[model samples]
Target: MSDQLFGSWMDKRDSNWVVFAYFDWIYSSGMFIQMLECLSKRWGFGTDDVDCRFPDNNSFDVDDHFSGVEFSYGLMYDPDVVIVSDEEFGRYLDMACFKYIERTPGSAEYVRSMLSRNEPGNG
Candidate 1:
């Protein structure tokens, strides 16, 4: 297992979800377990190995207030709870990117630009 942490958007059977996953190499067993526990309490469960179908639109949205802290610690949004509307899903996706990837220097602008390009009526 690699030590790096990673995140991505996913879907299954027309259901949409987001995931931030990592191997044990990056987090100690205790810490990893704690993280999962916190996630279960806050957002939802952490899957070991799972597979699902992709969304038809292939786009998501992030809320303006979404912070990356939860995702940085490995949060997976439960499809059942997340609304399927494009605007809301896009907000969630934006939040995930901002918190997970845009934290690094010079990433915010790039991410925002990418998101804008993908938004409806923009392209």
Candidate 2:
């Protein structure tokens, strides 16, 4: 990936999930896992390649150039879960997580393995 994309990925990975009062998607942890699976398929990553950021109030923007959109959270949230309406947003999330994991020295090995597998799932 290009340095700009890599930097964007890293920024989003470090951002915390915003809890919004307006959205109550009622998603379980299983939803997160399923989302990961879906993202792996769309982004050509792997099932175990994605990671989740802990919930916090920090503001950040996840820019997805592929879909020509940007996902912003935190400022819009109000202590509940922020419901993302777009499915393509998940791919950006996965990319961010993958980038974060891959940058962690020894952790890059796992990312390399996952990317090399090239197994596609339902995005």
Candidate 3:
């Protein structure tokens, strides 16, 4: 996406590129459990105790509500790498990250254009 478009996108959300980058890193690494925990803690769910099931310290048993919002954490000031093992889940996490990026303001068209450029057949 163009820098102008990306800038406009950033303007509309209470988010930073660093947070998005962390989302990318954690999802790619397959440490989605830690990602969710960090996000839940950030989102004030720390006191609620969601039934988060961490399988093998890598993946998290995230329900529908927790699937795609990890990029919005307010506490994680830095990014960390996660170790991934499942290819399909990894792809799913990657797609979810793209979706999060697309959901940001001024980013849908840019993201859509990117997807089309990357996979014309799928587009």
- Identify the candidate with maximal lDDT: 1
Q: What is the C-alpha lDDT of each candidate?
A: 0.37, 0.33, 0.36
Q: What is the TM-score of each candidate against the true structure?
A: 0.35, 0.27, 0.24
Best by TM-score: 1
lDDT by residue for model 3 over 1-123, one digit each (tens)? 332212322233433443344444444444444444343232221111111111332336333233322323223444322223233233434464365465454655544443343232431
lDDT (tens digit, per residue) of candidate 2 on 1-123: 332214222233344232211011112112333433433444322122222232222435432222322223333333222224334344545454464454445656654444433334522
What is the model-wide C-alpha lDDT for candidate 1?
0.37
Clashing pairs in 3: 29-82, 29-84
lDDT of 3 at 73: 27
lDDT measured at residue 62 in model 1 versus the true structure, 0 to 100: 36
Candidate with the larger lDDT of 2 and 3: 3
